[model samples]
Target chain A: MTDTTEAFRLVVVSAGVSDPSSTRMLADRLTSRVVAAAKERGRETTVTVVDLRELLPELPTALSSQLLGPRFQRAVDALSEADGVIAAAPVYKAGASGLFTSFFQVLDNDLLIGRPVALAATAGTARHALVVDEEMRSLFAYLRALPVPTSLFASTEDWADDALNGRLDRAAHELVLLMESGFARAVRNESWKRYQHTFGSDAGRELGIDTDTDLMRLAAGGSLVDSEDPFDPRTA
Target chain B: MQFGIMSVSDITRDPVSGYTPSEAERIDAIVKIAKHAEEVGLDVFAIGEHHNPPFFSSSPTTLLAHIAAITERLILTTSTTLITTNDPVRLAEEYAMLQHLSKGRMDLMLGRGNTAPVYPWFGQDIRQGLHLALENYNLLHRLWREDVVDWEGKFRTSLQGFTSTPRPLDDVPPFVWHGSIRTPEIAEQAAYYGNGYFANNIFWPKEHYRRLIDYYRKRFEHYGHGTGKQAIVGLGGQAFIAKSSQEAHAQFRPYFDEAPVYGNGPAMEDFEEMTPLSVGSPQEVIDKTLTFREAFGDYQRQLFLMDHAGLPLKTVLEQLDLLGEHVVPVLRKELEAKRDPEAPANPPSHADLVKAKYGDDEPRQPRPNANRGDNVTGGSPYQDSEAEVSAYPTL
Candidate 1:
């Protein structure tokens, strides 16, 4: 912002269950460092948390019918306006929690186009450390979100490792640069039409109708052909 | 606004009785349901088209024509005629023949069928459904309006001066309603032609339908049809009514729990909360139906899904009695009282269309010219028709 007082929105979606879970703690560390990095660049930042545990009751209806309950709508609303997103999830088996993947899967594919995201995960052992980069990053990539290169995966031992702090700082620096540059906002404002979107998409803040499409012309009873084929096999 | 009933023609096992009606029995029962709807004072009867088993209406015109013979005033229509799979030429001819048989007591709603496999069965790819719907309807529009159609499109075989007969009754085509859940292109097509737009708001929440309906109304005005409120609109509602709220719930619980599409998913109560499903006494149905007008404004038609989920003939008839006697009468008066005086009274019926096309004059009864062994390519196809300059160049 020109005044340097407006806060860049940072939404943290953590699927950690327990009160003081490591997954959220990992996301929190990333969020704080991002805020600090942005502040160093003379930009303000504000963070909003989306706890997937609170969204448990709404998941069944959403998974079955694609009906967004109130809590899910709020999450979509926050993410739509987010300048950057820190998505953290717990590794249950060899994969990310279904809750985390489902929350992203059900979102309108255009909702996070070009959005800066920091992917992180927590598990009991370092054996499942690749969950963030290998699995969760693919999900955000499908949504067209821009994930920072360094994925944060903290196991029980990595929580105490000083190297975890270095990786978090690098991700934060990359996210702050992406947000400060306004890459997501600029792409959305300038080239949103290039993306595929449906009418009632969650990213339906734009109700702009392009009357220039061939479909619109056809809707107005215009023909799809520019010139009739010289050879009519039906007649000849 | 006009009120009616629509059926998916589902053949489900009666969750209470553990019995499923045979295909012949279900087909015959559908005709009886249409007659009873008319007997009870409902204004319209529409049936869906399904190409699969357990849903019997593959030929809607055949069924609607039969219903039209038994009932005098009940408007015969389709909840949705597949616009994507069926050739627009056949649609134009068959629907025209039905219109003449029913003597202008019919109209049809068009949709891209949801069953994906059914698309391939008809030699069409579901991936091209939207384009098929838009392109096919464009050809169909001309088939009914022009005496001879010289057309070509990507999806279907090209036509060289093809005549879809017997040219629409009184030279006026049957009114069309484009039914869609979320496609704005379908709504735009409906608006461009000033046709009625119908949304089945029974399964999902009203908010989803509201956006598309609002878009239709806005584009309806943009296309120079009329004011947004004056644009013809239709909605779908579902209900199971009885003498009291508890009895309504008790009777419908088994069907709601075992029915396809919605069963084993959201609880009936949650569905009722989010959608246009009303399960209660007559007053409760009326009250819930009233809120639809509040959400979507004064519109033309309301059709309820009454005879599905294997409620049996006897119970469905009883539900219709409550609906016709108890629910619809109150809804009619309340919606009428609340409707803007300038809004349309009902969707354009055949007579309304004839009057609009030829006001205060005799409607043209098209007569084929005596062309020697030629159908459509001879100068003009009808005694009173002009040869189109270039049907494929009309943009």
Candidate 2:
């Protein structure tokens, strides 16, 4: 284990469309609170805010081509390399914004697996606040990201409500605790092989081609002729 | 290194002229393009295989046989012969017949083609694509190498005492190249068989293929084929060229912007920088191509995709002229200069394969024995076989 002096890198992905959207406001509040909480816990913190609006023009191209444009790649790289991620998306049609989902969709499927993610959502009415719990939580769960227990939802009225700050503080502290605990690094270091696809893994075995098979041996330039019995038993 | 061109056989309407060539015209133009490839001093001319509309290469051997009759020296090959859906026994027989027709002036690249729906059309499931590719190639490999094949696998029906006709020209099967864009398993497969690995290095970044090629090289050595540096590797590139860079970009932009595969995706400059696409002067093409050796190490073949995106045949021919006269000659020299002496100078040709197999002796000319009523009653079907003559001889 290393000392607590290392700076914890946090990335905030804000999927607000407008210049001063409340979704971004909620993101900024969450990021600052997380940073402050980390500092209180005697850990230094650095934050990168990825504004998804700037990536809109390239998203379709990225999705269609399965290749990321440079700008979008840089934003994705920042998130991928960060120690923790704060994802905040505005709710539209009772779900997280398409732009937000689209951004994550274009990422490599295994990229966010085992990373710590904090989910937040903003909607016009309190009725859609469950978008965080129902939509965002499931999204991160599918990605295999460990979402902190406390999810933040800010509605039109929640902005002025004092309880919003309390919820933000709780969620931010949980994320900071996850970061300081080094759960992400532990999972990445200890059991990463368990998560990856490799030559003899279950996926490779499922394909019916493993390393020791005759197909593999032949591929390795081994002769198929000189074996003790050339006929397959199944055929016999 | 062997420098050449490949076509996906897409029939798109010319974005600028708004005219689409008829199937007859496009097919004729493709043959003209192939002959022009040989005339321009290019060594290889490869055509793709597609079973659906918008692509016209369903019968590659038919088209290639015609191309073979017209040209003497051009090495004919498929940019990719579909291995997933096509029956391996048929692939073995058809390509063997092609080898005889071309007089061993041919080889093939195998790929599990990208289209999903084409699978069921051939009575196969798309979910088993990789398995089908693996099992089919395994059967195809044995079909060409062995005199008689008794095989069973998941996807295809059992083959008992099957002999793929024509028995490969001079008993040397056509050299194979496994072409893949993303699958490391394909590279592993290539390495395992000591066959060539071809990275269709278009539409993606060099870094993407670098990892794949690197894995192949390492596995090639791991399988004891050769040192990693000596692995036979081929790469696909895309280029449009002219005397001046401005003219090249100006002429190719309309086609590039409207191309069905990559159109409306990235800016021209960004795409060029990201992929192996060079859209400028012949000198720019030469310089960009030379960098591939540095990126992926000295490779065996460099094939460019030059005919798609509905560029007029006249312009495509001109592009070939520039490629043959300018870009390829310089690339050939520069790549050879940097190549390691121990590394393969070119991919194995018909002559090389024959020599490797026979070693100064006369190669086998297989004569089938008279067919018995039941194939199982036969000891062996060929005249050269040491098995007892239980079946009547052809004479």
**What TM-score would every model get versus the actual structure?**
0.93, 0.92
Residue B126 deviation, candidate 1, in Å?
A: 1.4
- After superposition, the stretches of candidate 2 with alpha carbons farther than 4 Å from their true spots are A1-5, A196-236, B389-395
Q: Estimate, for each residue in B171-258, the C-alpha lDDT of model 1 and write its tens digit.
A: 9999999999888789899999999999998776677778889989999999899999999999998999989999999999999987
Highest-TM-score candidate = 1
Reference-based TM-score, model 1: 0.93
| Candidate 2 docking class | acceptable
Task: Tell me the tens digit of each residue's lDDT in model 2 across B320-379.
Answer: 999999888888888888889988899998888888888899898998877665556666
**Evaluated with lDDT, which candidate comes out highest?**
1
Evaluated at residue B81, the lDDT of candidate 1 is 98
What is candidate 2's lDDT per residue for A1-236, written digit by digit as tens?
A: 54578999999999999978999999999999999999888888999989999998788678777667877878867866778999999999988999999998877655676778889999999999788888888888877788999999998899899999999999999998888787767776677655644432221121222466554554443434444433433333
